[model samples]
Target: MALPRTAPSSWMQSLDLPSQLFETGSTDYELYEEDDEFVLSVELPGFDPEEITASWDDGVLDIAAEHDDQQRGERRTYHRRFRFPKSVADEEITAEYTNGILEVRLPVEEAVVSGREIEIES
Candidate 1:
C-alpha cells in the first residue's frame, strides 16, 4: 500500500478552525522488499544525519525529525508512521543517511506459531 501524505496547510483554515501560525513540513517515503528484508526510503532534507529518531512498536514504525534553520528563521518538525506486515528484528535493523535520504533495512522474521498447550483438571 502506498503511504498517504498529510493534507495541505490550508485544510484547517477551510474547516473554519483557528489558523496554526507555525509551519509544518511533510516527509515522503517509499517501501519495498528485497531478500526477506523490507527496505524503507525516507526523504528528509535540511536535517542533520544524527538528529532523526526512529522506533518500532508492534508492527508500526514511527520516524520523527527536527531541523532548526536559524539563518532563515525557520524550524521544521516531521513525522511519519508505517506498519509492516510482520514483526521485525530490532537488533539487526540498520539505517543510513545519505544525501538527504534515509535508508533503513528491516529484516523480516519467519512466522512461528507462538503458544503452549497446558494440561487442565489435574
Candidate 2:
C-alpha cells in the first residue's frame, strides 16, 4: 500500500504573508557549496565596498550598506526593512566586500556519525 501524503506545515504557509509585504532588492545572490565551506555572493549596486557591513549572529547572516557620497544627495531617500533569522550567531561568521559585492564564507561543521545497528525485539 502507498503511504499517504501530508499537507505542508503551517510555518511554510506563513511565509507567504511576509513575502507579499516586502519586496526584495534588485540585488542577486549565489551560493556555492564546497566540501568544507559555503560561499555566499550578494550583488549590491549604488554602494561602495567600503560602506557595506556584514555580520552573522546565531545562524542568520546580516548584510547592510549605505550609498556612497556620490550617489547620495539631499533629494535621495529610502525606507525599507530587512529581517534576518536568529540562527546566525555573531561569532560564527566572517565576511568581506569588494567590487560592489559582498561575499560571506561560512565553514561547515563536521558531523559525527556512528555506524551501529540496533534490532528491536517485539
User: How does each model score on TM-score?
Assistant: 0.68, 0.52
Residue-level lDDT tens digits of model 2 in 1-122? 75436443444455666553344443367777655666787877566666667655456566766653655442322222233332233355567777756777777665567799899999
Off by over 4 Å in 1: 1-27, 113-122
Candidate 2, TM-score vs. the true structure? Answer: 0.52
Backbone atom clashes (below 3 Å) for every candidate: 0, 10
Error of 2 at 37 (Å): 1.4
RMSD of each: 8.4, 10.4
Worst 10 residues of 2 by lDDT: 74-83
Report clash pairs, candidate 2. 57-88, 57-89, 57-90, 58-87, 58-88, 58-89, 59-87, 59-88, 59-89, 60-88
The candidate scoring highest on lDDT is 1
lDDT (C-alpha, whole model) for all candidates? 0.83, 0.58
